[model samples]
Target: MMLPLILLYLIGYETRVTTACSRLEACNSEFRTGLEVAGIQEPESSAPYCAELRAYSQCIKKANKACRGDLSFHTSTAVIDSLMKRFKCAQQNWGPPYKRPSVKPKSNSICSHQSNSEYVHCGIFGDPHLKTFTKSYQTCGAKGAWPLIDNKFLAIQVTNMPVINSSSATATTKVTIIIRRVPGCAEEKTFEATSDAPLRPFFVDSSYSTGPEGSVQMKASINKTEKVEIYLRYIDTTLVVRRVGEYLGFSCRLPWDIAKIREENALELCQTGCPGTELLDIASSRGHRLSWETALNKCKQDMDLETGVRNNLTDQYLDWCVFDVMTTGKNEFVSTAHLAQEDVLYMDPSSLRNRTFPLDLNGIPKPSSAAISNVTLNLQVTAVVDRCGRNVVHAPAYEGAPQVGRVAIKVPPIWENRIPVL
Candidate 1:
C-alpha cells in the first residue's frame, strides 16, 4: 500500500522523538487527573482548563530539545496556542485535551546475537537494498509480502511499500518472522514490526525465553524505539529489524553451515533477490531523481560514519545513502545507511571485513552484468557505472551459480548443526 508523503512525515517525527513524546503523554495524563480531581470532566467554558492549557504549552516548549528531531512535536505548542485562542482563556478558560494520538512501547524487545565466525550476511534496508548470502547486492523493490527465509528452522516474511508518492521504488514497512518450533532449540515464536506501530517484544504466547536454559533457546530483546533485534541462538542466526523514518528496514546473519539451498527454499528473497518485475531503475528516473553529484555530496555530508563505514564496506553504502535520500527526498533518510552498516558490524563482523564463503571460494563463479541478461539472473550486488554514471547490474551467468527452477533434484550432504527435534 502507498502511504501519502504527509503521513510519512508525521510518522517520521514520532520515531526520533519517542522519548519526548512519552514524557508529553505522561504530562497529559497528569493534567487529565488534575481536571478529574477538580470535578471538571469536560470543561464547558474552558475556565477550569486554562491553567492546565498553559502548563501543557510549557511542557511542549521544554521538550523542544528532546523532540527536536520530531517536526510533529514542534507544532504541538502551536496547536495548543491555537486551541487557547479558540477557547478564549482571557474571556473564559482554555487548555489541552485529555486524549491525543499515541504510539508507546510497553515492553520493547532487545536483540542479542550469538556470534558465529563463519556466517553469510543477507541484509535488506533503505528503499530495500538486497545483499544475498553469496555477497551479491541489488537494490530492488520486493513489494507485497515475500518470504525472506522459508525453511525448517524459520519462516520470515517482509512487506514492502512505495517509498513516496509518484515513485515506483519501495522500502520495507513491515516484517513478520516466525522461528519454527524445534524441540531442543526454541518454541515456535513470532516477532513482528511495522514502521508506525509499536513492536511486539515477546512471542505471540507472551512467554519469554522458551528455549532450554543455556541451550538453543529464544534469547531476550536487543534494542530501541527505532530498532529491534531477535537472536535465534539455537541456529546461530541473528535478525535485525529497524524503523528508519516511515519505512521499515531488515537484515539477517546466518551461519554458513545453515545457509543451505534446498528446493523448497530456493525462491527466498535472501537467496533469489527480488523478482524481475520489482526491478527499479536507480540510474535513470524522472520522478524522485537526483543527479549523481547531488546524491554523492549529500552522503558525504550527512553519513556521519562515512570514513569508518568505508573501511568496512564498499561504495555500496554511499549508493544506498544516495538512493535513499533521493527516493524519499528526506536527508534524514541517509541515516538508514549508517544504521545498516552499524547493524552489520554488530550482527556480522566478518561481513564487514570481507566475503564469508568458506567452501571452494575460488571455484564458485560470482554473478555480474551482460552474462545473465538472457538467463534467469538471481542476485546482483556490485554494478559497473558507465560514463553517464548509470548503475548497471547483471547476474553472473555461470554453471557454479545455480538457477531457479522447479526440478526436484538430489543434493549433496552438507554439514548440519543438528539439534534433535524430539
Candidate 2:
C-alpha cells in the first residue's frame, strides 16, 4: 500500500510544481518596473524574459544589493527573474562558482607547435620550431630524439634535411656554442637570466646558451615540463646552437599482458581456496552409479565434440585446439556447450562459410560420428566459463586488423580463463 502511494507521489507531484511568480500581467508590469529599478533603458517588449532578468541581475550586482533568498515580499518578480537568469547563465560558464584560469601563450611570443605545449608557449617541453610547409604549420622532427630546427628562423638556407646529424655539402651556416652543466642543475632549479639584450627567436626546451663572462647564470632553459622563463640577453643576439643534454625514453606494456598476470594470480588463489573442489564437484555429480573414471571420460568426450562444433564457426583449426595449460586435469570432461551461446556474439559468422571439423577415431573410444558428441562437453564448459568471465570485464577489443575480411582476437590472460573458447 505504502509502495503504491510512494510511487504515485514520485511520478505525479514533482511535475506540477509551478513557478513562484506566474501572473503574466504582473510579470510584464514588473519587467517594465525592473528596467527603471535597474536604471537601464527599457528593452523592446519582444525581448526574452531571460534577457530582462540578466540585465536586472547586472544592475543589482553593480549596486551591491543582496541577490536571491534574502528577500521579503518586496522582491519583485522581475528582480527575482533577473537574478535567476544570471544564475542559470553563470552555472553554464562555471562562474560565481569560479573556474580555473586557462593558460595562454604570451601575446608577443609565438610557439610553432602548441600540441605538446601545456599552458604557456614553453610550459611543457615543446619544439617551438613549428614551420609552414605548402602554406600550413605542421610538426617536424627526426625518427629518433632530436630537436627540429625551424627553417623560418634559420640564417642560412638548406635544400633538404638528411639522416646524418652533422652538416654536409648541403649545409647551411654553422652556429656553434660551448656546453656546460650549471652548478645547481636539479629538476626544479630555474635557469638564470641570459643578458640585458632583447630576445628574437625562442629556443627549444632544456637547451640554452651561456651569458657573457660575469653573468649570474645561463640565459634561457626549459624545465622538464617545458615552461619558458624569458629574461634580458646581451651579445647573445647571434643565434647559438647548443645541444640538448639527454633524451627522455618511454615504454608501455600491453593491457592483455597485464590481464594474463592477474588471471594467473586469481587461479592460484582459487586453487588454494578450493583444494581440489573441481574433482569433488565432478565426483559428486556422477556418483557411484557410474564409475568415476567412466564419467570423467564421458565428460571429456562431450567437451571434445562441443569444441569441434564450435570449430565450424571458425576455419582456424588451431583456434579450436584445447591446450593442456587451459585445463587442470588431463582427459577430464571438457564442457564447451556454454560457448555456443557466446559464439552468436563473439564468433564471426563468415568464418563458418567454408570450414569443416575433421573427426578422427583411431585409439579414441568414440566413433567418428560420436567424436563430435565427445567434444561437446569440453566446449560447453569452456563457453560457459568464458561468457561468465567476459561478463566480469569486457576485453580490450580490436576490430578487423589485417583487413576487413579478417579479424584478430586478443583477450587478457585472466580472461583466457586458462580455458580455450573460440
Candidate 3:
C-alpha cells in the first residue's frame, strides 16, 4: 500500500526531529552551558531562569502533541517527556532572555537506479512536479532514449499425475499441467485417463492459440508411432490436486489398486448421509453396536481439530475417513474410556475491575496479606476421563496458586472420553 506523499514527508521530518533530540545537548552545548552557569545558586522553583525554562518545556510539549495527533506519525510519549526535561534544564540554567534556535529543513527526494547509465527521479501523487516528470519521460522514450519492449516468455510444466495405471496390455495416466506466462499470468489443466503410451515422448506447442489476445495456449501431443488416449478435463474435477510450481520433474510406478473407490462414488457417499450417524449404522449392520451420542461426540471432536466438518456426508467421509479410525480401512474398537478424579481450582467474584497484578514466575498473583484475607481459593475434586477411558483412576486435582488483584481465572483442562467405539 502506497502512503500519501504528504504523509511520507511528515514521517521523514518526525524521524529527523527525533534523531536531533537524541543528541540535543551536544548539538547546543553553548546554550545549555549558559543556562547551567546562570542558575547555579537558585532553586528551580524560584530561579530567575524559570520563565525561559518554561518556554522551552512548553515548546517541546506542543511539538510532541502535534506529532502524536498526526495519524501519519507514531510518536513516543516517553521520548517527548525526556526531551522536555532536557530542554527545561537547559533553559533554567540560562537566565534572562531566551531565543529558540531555528531548525533547518531536510531534503525530500525519491530516486531509484533504473539502469546502468541513468538514474530515475520519481514524483508522488498530489505533486505537480510528478506530471512534468511523467511527460518528460514519455517524450524522451518516444525519441528512443528509453524504449520499452515485451521480452517475456511463456513456460509450461507438468505438476502431477494423480492417476497412473499401466497393465501388460494397456497404459493409462492422468496428468495436471500448469501454464505460466512469465511475469504475467497462470492457468492449470488436468487430463484424465488420457495417455495410453505413458513412456512416449510428447511435443508441447506454445503458439497454438491466438484468438484470445495475451492468452498463452499449450498444446501437447504424443509421438505418431505411439497409440494414446488424450482426454482433457480442464481445471474443475472431483480429485483434489494442489498446484505446485512452474517446473517439476518426477516419475514413479506402483501397483494400481483395482478395487479403489471411484472419485464420483466417494463424493456421492459423503453427500448422502451424516458422518457419525452413517458410520454408526454401518458398524451396527456389521454386528457392532454403538450409541449415536458417543459416535457423534467423537466425530465432532475430531472434526474440530481438523478442518471444519462439511455438510455433505460424501465430502466429510472423503475428508475424515483417512484420519478417523471408525471409517478408515478396517473399523475396530481401538481404545476404551475410564472415569478419573482430579482437583480443579476456582476463583471467586470472577470479574475484577483491575486486571494488572504482581505475578510470580508461575504466573500466580501475590496479593498483600490484608488483601489475601478476603481473597478465596478453593480446590474441588471432579470426575474426568482417563487417557484410554477404560477404567476409573483417582488423581490429584491440578490448580495453580492464586493471583492477587486480577479477577480473571485460568480454567484447567478437563479430561474427556476420547476413545471412539462401536
User: Which prediction has the highest lDDT against the true structure?
Assistant: 1
Report the candidate with higher lDDT, 1 versus 3: 1
Which of the numbered candidates is closest to the native, going by highest TM-score?
Answer: 1
Whole-model alpha-carbon lDDT for candidate 3: 0.22
TM-scores of the models, in the order given: 0.55, 0.14, 0.16
Q: Which tens-of-lDDT digit does each residue in 149-247 have in candidate 1?
A: 888888889888887767777778889988778776576787777888766556667754567553333333323226566666566576767775577
- TM-score comparison, 1 vs 2, better candidate: 1
What lDDT would each prediction earn against the true structure?
0.55, 0.23, 0.22
Model 3, 1-422: lDDT tens digits are 11111121111111212122422322223234435556433224334445444443444454554344432223333333343353465444445545545343223211111111111111101000010101110000011011011111211122122111210111012233232232222233222222333432222432333212323222332221111122111110111111111111111111112111134423211111112221211211111132333333443332222212111111112112212222222121111000000000000111111111111112123333343223212111112233654423222212221222222222232212321221
Task: Give a tens-digit lDDT track for model 2, residues 1-422.
Answer: 11111211111111111123223223334444544444444222223433555543444343333324422112333335444543464343322321122223233332111121111000001111111110111111222222222111111111112212321101111121222233322111122212122222344344333343322123322321111222211111112121111111100111111112222223221011111221111111111233334333344342244223222222222112121101222221122211221121121222222222221111123213243233321111111123444422211112211112322233333323433332
lDDT of 3 at 75: 30
Between candidates 1 and 3, which one is better according to TM-score? 1
Model 3 worst lDDT run, 10 consecutive residues? 337-346
> How far is 160's C-alpha from truth in model 3 (Å)?
56
